[model samples]
Target chain A: MTTTEARPSKLTPRGRATRERIIQAAAELIYEHGVQNTNNERIRLAAGVSGSQLTRHFPTKESLVRAVIAWRADTVIALHKIPQLGHLDTFASLRLWADSYIEREELCRGGCSYGSLAGEALKAAPSLRPDVADGFERWEDLFRAGLTAMRERGDLRPQADPDQLTHLLMAAFQGGMLLNQAADDVAPLRDALDAALAHVESFATHPVPHDDATGGEAP
Target chain B: MTTTEARPSKLTPRGRATRERIIQAAAELIYEHGVQNTNNERIRLAAGVSGSQLTRHFPTKESLVRAVIAWRADTVIALHKIPQLGHLDTFASLRLWADSYIEREELCRGGCSYGSLAGEALKAAPSLRPDVADGFERWEDLFRAGLTAMRERGDLRPQADPDQLTHLLMAAFQGGMLLNQAADDVAPLRDALDAALAHVESFATHPVPHDDATGGEAP
Candidate 1:
């Protein structure tokens, strides 16, 4: 694991709020335009921070990226416990997750924040890579656990590889997101996810019977 | 398809060669550093072009990216028909096709040039999306074509959905690449590929007879 260090900074209460504002702006920008394409000046302008104030909080772009990743990490960790994932319909579970992903993109038109950060940090900030690695694997674990539960219920093929399926699902999600950012329309994502979920459906050993109880929505 | 008009300026022989050199260098840099991260100055340095000369040829960062994508599209379209894809060991075929994907990543660290360019040009270059769409669909075509060939030889289950399997394989390949990029290693690729191939192997309905002269790869 790379030893990541946040740059030193001090902020008053109002300053801290301003700093948070800067990060929120940065997160939006970085997700859409990508971290490398965005400049500190732009970030300062977006956050309504003076030049001195921006540097006083985050001295480097990398630090700003780390803050976004940390904040995103909190969201992912909070909403995506294994048990919580287990309770939702696979389609609905995925759409809820897509909320953060889609909202972030519209906010900045950047690629994914964690993905963009990880790509930038790959060479520039090695310390941040482990956080990226750990974060991605955590999502993989959640998917694997959820799939395992479904399989135990005799929904999936006996030989279905949960870990592999997890990787496939995550890949399509991110790849679709990446393409959607490029294309600016959400159609690629819709196609990729629809295709992926359809593949998941086919792998079930037993045909998925239609639920007659409250068929329109999940309780 | 959106028309992204890059000013490919008319050049003398020397100027043409230099422009090609710059495009090649930018391709390599984008592969390593990502599309947005590699700047005109870095591009100039890498291509051994003076800053003035680089800007003379490519007025915008987007122009340089456009040229790189044009260059790579040639490389990406290298899928000459392989008549024996199914008969060959699955791993061998995958390895042969996987190189450009990896090299493509090195050129555009976070994405395929198709992915990156279409992303940037989605609104401006709708006409160009098909090229990007083709790249996305190519892997599935290969997998589907291979499975169809296998079926002709009575090697696949009669009920197997080659089209769906191709989509699944495509997702797995893309996903595995994402994991490989994040992990900064090839092992995940190997592991993930192995697992997917195993799933494909399970669909083998007929054992290869020893009498076939070219079928020794599978046990």
Candidate 2:
């Protein structure tokens, strides 16, 4: 099933707004109620869209789920505006990025958007695993970019592998988010991020004399 | 709705087997299809139980869900019979425990059972959140016990607060599990566990002079 990209380009601006509204409402409903409990009919009612409108945007539940996955992934990546995420040249920027996620978790009182969908969708919607995996790949890319920048700038030691570290950081962050969701606290996330950041910090190159270069301290 | 404890004491061996079958079937079905996609009829069919028999054990879907949560929690904890978890007295035991989980993640081809359920059920089954949270607490207690053992043995430094480190380890493990689920690989889990174990190793105290005490190597 096609997602937003499948929409006809001949639509007016109002058409675009309505389509977005349906997706937004569906995302929130799915987020709160889960994919199985939330159906297209409920989405129609919640989105203030007619049956035709809902169908026009998402012809099937699979299509709608795919759209939600894409939409949520984009929203998550876009919201985390930081250097290492976008540039990834330092430990300080990585910490700032971690803080942003922790703060959002506090405000939202939910796990990662992609993760929530994934836990529900992976088994039930086997076809969409790649889409969810793609979302994660994109996230890893952000870290990879930052680490690459650090490597180029002579900040990271030669032994540090950005690709492996990127995977490690993403996994650590996802695991911490899961624990935080279960405990309804940020301690899990904080620890996981700290550990990951510290691992990355362990690779810092020391240019100064007799300097201890492990970036273990949280910025 | 009540859980397994609510069952009558007069049940024969056959009745007991049937009840266990129903829960086991429900857990597998839910694990593969999610709670929403798998229904009472499917569960009954899978368990080879009659409608009345299913209803006799779990009067409501919520009750069945609660039973599943309780059953799965016990099963997960019981299966991981390692140090700290089985016996948490040394860093070697912890490494062994980490290796066991990484292996299980590969065998199961899914994330941590508790973590997957927590993500999907936290919002959909808010009533069950505490049950899930309680499960995590039990897991954390295992870690805490291990850390406390290390401290008492003079393996850990005096500054290591088992409680805080317990929370950190749990969170890091959970985050890494989530990433592994998304990516369908063990690298994330390995990385996260390594990071956590290394951090824990950092807290080790050396009683012997001129000894390198950080138990950083994976067993």
The candidate maximizing lDDT is 2
Q: What are the lDDT figures for the candidates, one per model?
A: 0.58, 0.75
Cα-based lDDT at residue B32, candidate 1: 60
Candidate 2 per-residue C-alpha lDDT over B1-219 given as tens digits, one digit per residue, 9 for 90 to 100: 335544646778888888889999999888887777789999999999999999988888888887788888888777665335457567777777777777676643666777777777786888888888888888777788888988988899887768767766776667677677777887776766766676677777853222234223332
Per-residue CA lDDT of candidate 1, range B37-149, in tens?
Answer: 57877888989999888887877665666667767655554443455333333434644444434445453345444443444433233444554555556534656777787
* Candidate 2 chain A: 10-residue stretch with minimal lDDT: A208-217
- Please give fnat for model 2: 0.57
Give me the displacement of residue B184 in model 2, in angstroms: 2.4
RMSD versus native structure for model 1: 6.6
DockQ (0 to 1) for model 1: 0.26
What is candidate 2's lDDT per residue for A95-210, written digit by digit as tens?
Answer: 66776776676643677777778777886787888888898888778788889988888989776778767866776677677777777888777766766676677778863222
True interface contacts reproduced, per candidate: 0.22, 0.57
Residue-wise C-alpha lDDT for candidate 1, range A92-195, written one tens digit per residue: 56544544454455732444445545545554455666667777777577777777877787777676667666665676666666555544555444444545
